[model samples]
Target: SQDQTWNDGGDFDGTNTFICEWDYEDALSASVKEFGGHSYYVFSGDCYTWEEAKRFCENRGGYLAVINNQKENDELYKLMLDFGYESAYFGYTDKEDESHWKWVSNDQSTYENFNKAEELGDVEPNGDTSENYAMFYYKYKNGAWNDGDFGFYTVNSGKAFICEWDYTNPTPYNLNDGNYTLHYTTNLGREHRSVDFDRTYDIDNIATERFTKNYQTDLAYILSVMASSAYTQGDLVYNLITLGFNDYSLFNYYDNPVDERYEEDSCAFSIAKKELSNNSTLVLITIRGSYGGFENGNLLNEHSDWYSNLTIWFPELVGFGSHQGFDAAKDKVFEQLKEELGGDLLKSNVKYMITGHSRGAGIANLLTKEMRDEGVSVYDIFNYNFACPDVAKRNFLRWNFKGKYDNIFNIGIAGDPVSILPGVPGDIISLGGHLIAQWGKYGNSYWFSDNWAEEYITYDTDLHASENYVRMLSNQKDIGNAKNWTQMQGKKVRNVGVDVIVKTTSAIPVLSGLNATITDTNGTPIAKINGNEIEYYTTDNIEINLNEYEDQTSISVNGKSDVIVEFSGIDDTNIEILVVSTSENQNKSETIAYFEAVP
Candidate 1:
């Protein structure tokens, strides 16, 4: 073996044949070893160029070994002794900048091991720009590094090289329990908004507040209806104020400004002033979601390195930026609000609430940060977002918003995908294969775990639908009070009456022409047999018109109706009821109520 020589021509010429025996340790060959918490594999068969060798190692899920210290360099030199070769390529290079060497793995290495002096006299790595790559030279002062080129048979010829892999650091999405509180607002009713007057309410109080869940469910439904395309922008504002949102009034609406750059998708927002019972007004800013060209604009606005860079560059903005697109959209929205409300609205007594669904929700998140950074009082601001995306960079969110806003709540459905995307770009990189696992770290998230038996929870965009969110919240009840009730059916009994209630699920106000029908337990239409039909009445005891007959039965009322029924029976009977609304631009009908008939 000592008489043999591995020439640059890839020939083994000498006396006896040499046996390259490699010992085994665990899954690694003796040629493979560990140094500085990284695994390195050395190969010395076929010659390759620097680029070819780099690609060869990359295909194996690693890059050429990057030596960081004298200890590591010495270990690599000892491992090279078995190869019977003078040199091998490693991971050091100054390809980007001739003066500053860099590791192929993108890590910054401070240590260098160039030969101080050579047998020829001067030190190695003296070729300057001509030699951009480095190789470990065995004879140069006991394996010191030498600058080399990529030419074959030359100093940088594709020879044996080491591949390094890092497997020690844990993955980012390990679900470390976050320090913030988690609130499930699915069951809160709308009334809790008005009832909870004290601004001192904390997470614990919100978690345990009575009627809170039901209130939230109601509000979610209302907001979902508001997000529908059924009503015009002006009509939406009027309907919101008219439909029991008496505490709030529209401040102004900002139409998407016209700009040639944003010809595809534009942005719009509306402001509402809530007059609290405590003599203070709360400003609510609601941004509109994708409509027509705006969708294209949102998708085209590429991610920026800085939060406000794009907005600063272009007054007419269209994309979600590092600050989650607030720079383009919210900057204008904030400016409009400040101009409309004047300085008086920024007083300590004036509170602020921001809300939106989809793209609007994303804007709200960034706007919250912008307002807070501008010296706005944190305690006076409350943010409730639905199905929003990760608006800003992870570091920006962690350092700026996380643990800073106590009243902010982000509600998302378990299966919705929109709430988790624009993930670490490239397809090869994922955050533990779950977006929520990464976004959940940024704030207090309220996830609706019950996905209604959705097959693909994460990819189901239907689950992201605003209406479905409201429906799920409305149907969800406290676990302790879960039960089923009975409904009553037909048979006229003297002095016994059934009460009918009509409710509207649309954001558009319905005035009149609402109707109701009664059916038996078997779902068969029923009517009075002999002058004893169901009667329609209002809350003021005023009788309304009804067309009731045994064969053809139907009862019609105005916007809302109260009905009284007379049924003759000795045992309780179940009955079905259906209510239809004739309001324009609204859903046709819905099952209003069901009851049991008592004899």
Candidate 2:
């Protein structure tokens, strides 16, 4: 719409010919739009302190933003300068702590490009170093607004602030994963999954003998071979093929079943010599788990980041071995140790302690026992922690502690009951006579060496006093008592030559102390028991066949009842018998490597 007065031919005629209505409302509705692919906005009200301003912006569902790029900073500078908004509080102030200026929300610096001359203004001379924070001010000299740095301030000082937000990129997926790529995402701000080893050992054996000349010279080659075989046979395939392979490759120049050259962090000789000469008072001789070493086959490259003066001595022992044949394997360890270091290693004055975590503890216990059995005089053998199915053979000055929540040794099976006991019973009382034990967390148990001299630990009088220590129980269960019981009676009972006690609250079924007779074909009492029940215990399987005499065995209880069984006189075979006392309940099945037994 137009309202006009036209002048023509040098003559001015006011309100000449055409007139139109003019709407003044359109002029008031003009919206401010940004140009050059950018926009800007200034703080609207009176200035507030940095903290107050931050809170105000946060209340508006946004944070005090930081300038991420120069272009945005330029846009902000121009907008503020042109709009006559002189000095205003920006999000750049380091109110939390100065000198370590990081954005309160998304920390990024806008003054990284500030000139040296202007940088002097960023810090106040003789001011508190801890109170360095940046602000924005319009420079009257240059007619421009620039980000300025300042120090701590009082919250009451009102200052206008601009809130900048990140609009340059798309938002990330979630808070946990963070605004980073998957490959770069950090867990706990630490690179937890980085590989520790760079060298990898690939076992290829069909090569020439000339290539492995150096491997033949390695002193530990034979031990490594034996260890590898022991690992594979013991169902520690994961260790042999993975962690063991790494350690071996680093120390030796050969692959499995083959002679070859490899690399390690340092030569074994150097490492051993350094350890022996170390002046550190307390040396920790740790049996690395089947998978504790560097991966692939590499030295610990990043250890420098941990400590400068600490020395780490890693030994490969108490390695993988079958629990079934653990004693024999332990014997080998003792024999080999004696053969290698026999008198020399034992006499070393270095104050060192041996400790193992899980399976390693089993090996440590075995070695401790073997050392004692061989009459090898030793300073002290410390058994820190052990898992289930592990029995203390010979007493040592070792401490035994296990949690009651541990379950490694309690599991059992129907076919075999003796699988869980260690080795075979011997001529002496089992150091850990209570066959069935309740272990604590992770089935870790510790038997202190003090127990040997004092019979039992003074502090451990109740045995169950410490809930952290696994509680031991005899394997023998009163069958008559157990079968008739309506409730579980797990109370520990002493076995006095067959005299038994039954729970009164439940059906009291006790084993008969008096012995009955068992006949084969004609008539005879024949039952043979082997292995030590008090000392070292080994696994045993019971096979019962009812043939001649109808497989008859009689049991007579002193106070309760007399019972007898008869096998049908089927065929002409003598009756095979299996007799288990009330105390012989346990899992005795051995693991044939890794395959779970199929029944």
Candidate 3:
């Protein structure tokens, strides 16, 4: 066909599969393609959301193919030309901050395979906030990439997808042998390795020093400041890395393009994590606030986009609901996070530390409450919402989940006007402060020092700007630090313990809890696990059998099942450790990590 109808990804994803076109064997056999020591499994049998596709690929022992260069893209695109697929989901998306696109594998892809609007008539990645994930070779050719919705809206679109498996060159943590690549075992007992982390730490001295070591008290403020960057289009990797997060999912809808919602703007948030010594992870999710500017004619309200902020109300019920706009915004961010992180995994085994500013702050507050409602253990989440507005019916949590969200910490400027916005003005009915419209927020509140030297705050009207907040936080070392400022207890509104850091290269299977045990087989006392921390000891006795460290200690970290992480080491040399985990139901094995530390 010379002409094909172009459908918008936001068109409700109304698609159906009349018949199954391919099967697992078909995808593996004839559709199997190889490049750069990796395998690609192509299938046109089903159309799935970007998140669904990613999870499917991982379950198949790979991930959505992350095309790195033009050659790789061309190779796959050429083969796909014979098919009738309208589009396919890949491993790339700008879900984190709309400004900077990244691979799901965090490959740091420098190659751009975008089509020119002049030639193809469609600008790549121009779908704005509604479409964050990337779809491959849609309307035009040349392996062009377009920012697409999670699901391909049309019938022909998203029917084909490719999975990439790198058993040889697994990213972030790789152990290359002289003539070959060493292997390890994991959850599924060694099917494939992982592709997260930035490799910022020296693999050799992870025991002695880790880049993700510093767990600071002021981290909440620093990350909330970084959250402001999502309001603008920029790279967040470096900043998050500095904050000790080796792996993160940055989702942004704050890009200042003509927005999709006339009454309710989209939002942005990031889910990041750092590996700790005790085989545990410290997870932080930061949400971005209103992308505002003084040029928009509102000096006082930096949530300057007047359209979305103009109307405010609870969606359904009046006295027992959240603000429609902010609530929907929170749902969008949370859904994307669950879809990306895998819902069950996020709900269990992992905890969260959340922070945000302004609109993002409001959303984060509601999000924290929702996370609790949706089975994300309350003890597993701690939120810090800054310059936040009310997002719920005030008594929403007071009567039901009282004291449940005590970990939430909401901070704001003393006289910031936005805090009271949509105030008693937006709605004509003017219900009590406990009812709705920026009234219900779930957390403790505090005011920053009011006597900030005027130099820190650039404009009296726009003190809610992310930079200004950063400045105030800079003056006050602690986010909880507040002084002489009078509390405007007006109409009220609204909003994790990591035992050990175990870096796993493979996807951890679904489990109730991680049960850890150290056996006295080889060298049980070499590395000791404390409360959420690991302490290592050195034996100067050269007579001690260094060979004993190879299979010395065994670990079992799942409460209901047997998920094992075995550790081994060398004496003042490259550490050779093999990690394994076996799945009980699947009866399969996979290698989560294979470490060869070069001294």
Candidate 4:
């Protein structure tokens, strides 16, 4: 009854479909003209169908219609309303598909066209199951166009449409890597990988292997922690009284037959002296907490903390997985590690490294801290993934790797055990996260063997090993992966003293107050005058800022040629200039002609 003709068919009313036009004086004038106004000149009346209207408009060398943005859309709406027009038809309809309504101009939708939802229980559309098309309606509130459906037809029938166009083209991307190779190894015996050309085939396999290891380790650590209780500060008392466990022990691994918790006389460490007799080429002894034992035949004793022996007591939290714990058993282990690997570990000639996994990992990390604090050169410490509470230590390169779905990633959802320092993200590496599991060292011989010692720790090997594991500890170089890795600042690599020549057409072109300062190979400005020659030092191009002009301007240079001659006062002059090589050491300076200005 309220004119369904305007909803679908072409002929609606005297005001529904109409067009207007105006001639522009220039491009700027044309761009400034607004599309809607109450007294605008109507070029075509309400007489064309959706297709006919488009053809009619485009055939006249113009687009159907374009609403630039939201502001313009509102302006057009207001202008139509002022003209007493209800739902004046524009150049938008779902002729291509009943869904995906778009502008015929380019078949794209802008932010202005998308509709908002109505109030509660109000039958809305386009919710996952509904089609994806823009709609138009009169009395449109909450961004929904009625399309007259809720009032007259079914939910899918009465919808209107609009169109848009983008004049700019898409940008291109970088895609070059010819020097990449997969089998290349650095001087340190560490291998580098590549993902280019034919090597791209191997990338997927490498990615899959890395992903699987990280995923598996995260799953295991989460399960172990979830099945364990939050160990508190005084937990060591109960742990010691039960005799159930000692330092570096997992409660889950103990059986309660006897009340006394005894140390497991596990397999002694295997020590093979390469050439026992007359082999004194600086014996590099590495005294680390390997296999949880020592050379003195001392099996690691369980700690007083029950959380450290989580193999026995586990906690189940609803709507949460596991939590952080703060306790003192950790401190005792730190103290013992310091006493055992004291000066012997930090000797300059001794390539010693202290490392650990699980509780041992936490201890090894702390040892490095204590040694460094005592002014010892204990640079060879690498702690793999450890199941210990949060703590902070610095000046060490640590990396922490986290899995996307690892429950540990949601630690913030639970309660934080300790607050991370400023700029450190709460991820594994930030709070001491690293990818390699406690036992990952066993896979690579170079890791545990002494023959593979380098002056500095082999960063490539560390990176590869860590990348191959579940998560890596935070390191300074890993910027792309971890957030905290970005906070660190170090020496920046730079390329300086690049030489480029500028050709001038005239000799000493009108030097009215023309002046230039120069520098040498080290960017040090040079000052010297020899007879008829002036020696200027700079690899950076010399700039001549011409302020005023003087007729009898005199200038001379040694032999460098990349001098930059500029103009400010006058133009159209050519000069023969001699340049000398005071240019930076990285670049060569040559002599050339100069021009005043481009005529």
Q: Order of candidates by lDDT, top first?
A: 3, 1, 2, 4
**TM-scores for all predictions:** 0.36, 0.23, 0.42, 0.20
Q: What is the lDDT of residue 496 in candidate 2?
A: 12
lDDT score, candidate 4, position 228: 18
The whole-model lDDT of each prediction reads: 0.46, 0.28, 0.50, 0.27
Local accuracy of candidate 3 as per-residue lDDT tens digits, 323-394: 666777777877876775666545444556677777778888888888877777656676777777766554
Model 3 local distance difference test score:
0.50
Lowest summed lDDT window (length 10), candidate 2: 265-274
TM-score, model 2 to reference: 0.23
Question: TM-score ranking from best to worst?
Answer: 3, 1, 2, 4
Superposed model 1: Cα runs more than 4 Å off: 1-235, 243-266, 294-324, 396-402, 423-442, 451-458, 476-599
Model 4 residue runs over 4 Å out of place are 1-305, 308-343, 378-389, 392-479, 485-599
- What's the true lDDT of residue 390 in model 4? 29
* lDDT for position 361 in model 2: 38
State the weakest 10-residue window (summed lDDT) of model 1: 484-493
Q: What C-alpha lDDT, on a 0 to 100 scale, does residue 412 get in candidate 2?
A: 16
Question: Candidate 4's residue-wise lDDT over 159-248, tens digit each?
Answer: 122212122221111123422211111112322221122323222222223332122322222212211111111111111111111122
